[model samples]
Target: MILERIIPTVLSVRRILRADPALVKAYGGDPEKHTSLGLVTCDQDDAMYVALDEATKHAQVDVIFARSFYAGAAHASGRLSGEILGVIGATEPEAIENGLDALLRCLEHDACFYDADGKRTVTVFPHVIASLGEYLSKEAGLAPGTPMAYLVAPPIEATIGLDAALKAAEVRAVRVQPPPTETNFACAWLTGDLDACEAAAVAYAAAVVDVAAQPRR
Candidate 1:
């Protein structure tokens, strides 16, 4: 029987940013500070996060092979074709066409997996495609084309160490005072992962609730 793929919707604490207080006071009264932002998982599995963390830790990474149509056409010169032509010139055209098609697929796959920010961005992996298209349009001096879609394998390693560190640390959530408007983002300092992290949040909230419930000691 074929095993079903398991994907988890992850909520990471990394995306959160701090907010300003003076502005809050100006508008009303006390500014509630927030340190971290919760990131909703784009997919079902934490494999992508684990994989990205692994790739970041390891050096000498393996090169994933991808063949672009343009790259394949450039490489398919008479010299390279000559060897195959000698064996089967009568059917050379068909073989060359097939090779070109395969090359296009390879290029498309590579384009999909191309990522710059590693784990931080891997959670929002699909966004990379749009980001790439925008980048390529500017670099290539051409109008942006509709974005292409592709799948990426999560990193081959797990991030057990990072997980352990987050669990062990006592992080305070704080809002940042604004220097720039863009700097004014909301954030929190909770652990990663949906279940464990959320459970921790619930536990913390329960403790707070319990404290409030107690009469003045």
Candidate 2:
């Protein structure tokens, strides 16, 4: 097996393994051993396909998941830029690195970006997963009857809106989903007392207008 039997899931189907990890069980093995997740961006769809093909040929790694143009926007020149986000698992750390090197070489001279986060080296799973659990929890630690507000704006104003909301009141920044294109809008979630939520909403609205008036990058 190319993956060297990393994790054993209850379901005996490949499709089920990719959809949700919550159902998967570790068979006396590390769930994230020698695993890496990456985001690759390219302006053309053809380039993305070629890169994925070459990367697999060069290294003994399992392509856990892949999706093209998942969060990419159209170019200003009216061309569709493509993005591929996927996870690679290997028996050894060197194998994963070799695979990334090969992938980059295949993408040489192309206007693309490669971002890989090595799970073994830098660990953020505990904090991230905990935050998610808290956010999704029914008894969400907040004061009873507290309200939540969502601020929606274009991508450009995402940072500004978050900053404005925090400065406006004592509110918990629940989440921020940035926009992928002009057609998509950035959304921020805030939770706090009723009066603070109202203030945060106004602040976010003002931030959105301010960003909209600025020159586009």
Candidate 3:
């Protein structure tokens, strides 16, 4: 049997709505928004709870997905990108991919979260071609390749990595972890095979959770 694990990264609705007043009016609410909005004022943990609640409703469905709550205050008010990405990248690559794939699948349907103004604010997943092209140019110092090449390269690399990992392992496993905030973690999972990739992903998820559960120094 094929094992798969998923972890999702999500944004807070209250924070988003607060940032843009236009969102409030879009959801059929009064144009004259109050300084104190009740429903959307919760913190990242609250946002995660909302996202998880929504995810649970769709759990019985065949589609795959997961959700992780992120502190909008940290991202917006403070520059926590480095720290956030570090936490996320600490997880295994395979785990990240599975979670992302499931998230993408969920996104395909209308299950994505919307702001009070009804604007879709979810952007946890990255586009393959654009992401890969940017990576090659920026990191690898390679010129942009053909669209076909860009599309094929990531999966091919994934397949090779999966094959290698599977050969090293005695048994198959499913892995999952919270999505990373940095481009590095996201790109690593994208650069491998879809089938053999799950084990590494499961391993990564397990590691990430273990680390997160550990007491801070």
Candidate 4:
């Protein structure tokens, strides 16, 4: 329960998923040649954490991101407490399966899934695209065949920098990551003509510092 009460880690992999779907897809391809991703859900938050720890110790795997105890109206109604959801990554498909087995074998009803060998049982939380029109809504014709410029800063300044960057210049593609890296740093990209990208990058960097350095209201 205590583990569930803590806020979840930021899903930094989402940024990677959005930027280069093909690249990630390749990385998560055949379990025999490439790495795979896994997801595990548990009703007991503490048990999940312990199991994950044991699994990692016994198997070669990495934890992408995890969360426990997401509170909602159902919790307020006393219908539920909270649950643990975690993502694991491994270099081989067998490693993923072994890791999950080591962790979940003790549990009676373990809900575990993996992406390997033409089997995709789990949905990576940050990689789903439900609507088609939303993707087409962005007009790439605004600036074609242009280079992109990136501005990196603290996550706390994502809003300030992103707003200023878009307003400063015309851009074709833009991606903002409030928590891009493991260090919790943020970054934004502006794609357009070289001149426009440079201008937007400058505005974005300045706005981030100016906004984040200010005192709270």
Model 3 stretches astray by more than 4 angstroms: 1-73, 77-105, 108-187, 215-217
The order of the candidates by lDDT, greatest first, is 4, 2, 3, 1
Residues 99-146 of candidate 4 have per-residue lDDT tens digits of 777666533332121121122211111111111111111322223233
| Local accuracy by lDDT, each model | 0.25, 0.44, 0.27, 0.45
Q: RMSD of model 2, in Å?
A: 17.8
Which portions of model 1 miss their true places by more than 4 Å? 1-188, 215-217
TM-score (all chains, Cα) for each model: 0.17, 0.34, 0.24, 0.33
TM-score preference between candidates 2 and 4, better one: 2
CA error at residue 9 for candidate 4, angstroms: 26
By TM-score, the better pick of 3 and 4 is: 4
**Residue ranges of candidate 4 with Cα displaced over 4 Å:** 1-145
lDDT (10s digit) by residue, model 2, range 1-217: 1111112111111112222233122212224543333334444332343344445566775554444453333432323223333344455656666666655664553312211122211101000110211112222344323466545544666567678888989888766667652334465667877678778866765665555455364
Worst 10 residues of 1 by lDDT: 82-91
- Relative to the true structure, candidate 1 has a C-alpha RMSD (angstroms) of 24.4
lDDT leader:
4
Question: What range of 10 consecutive residues in model 4 has the weakest lDDT sum?
Answer: 121-130
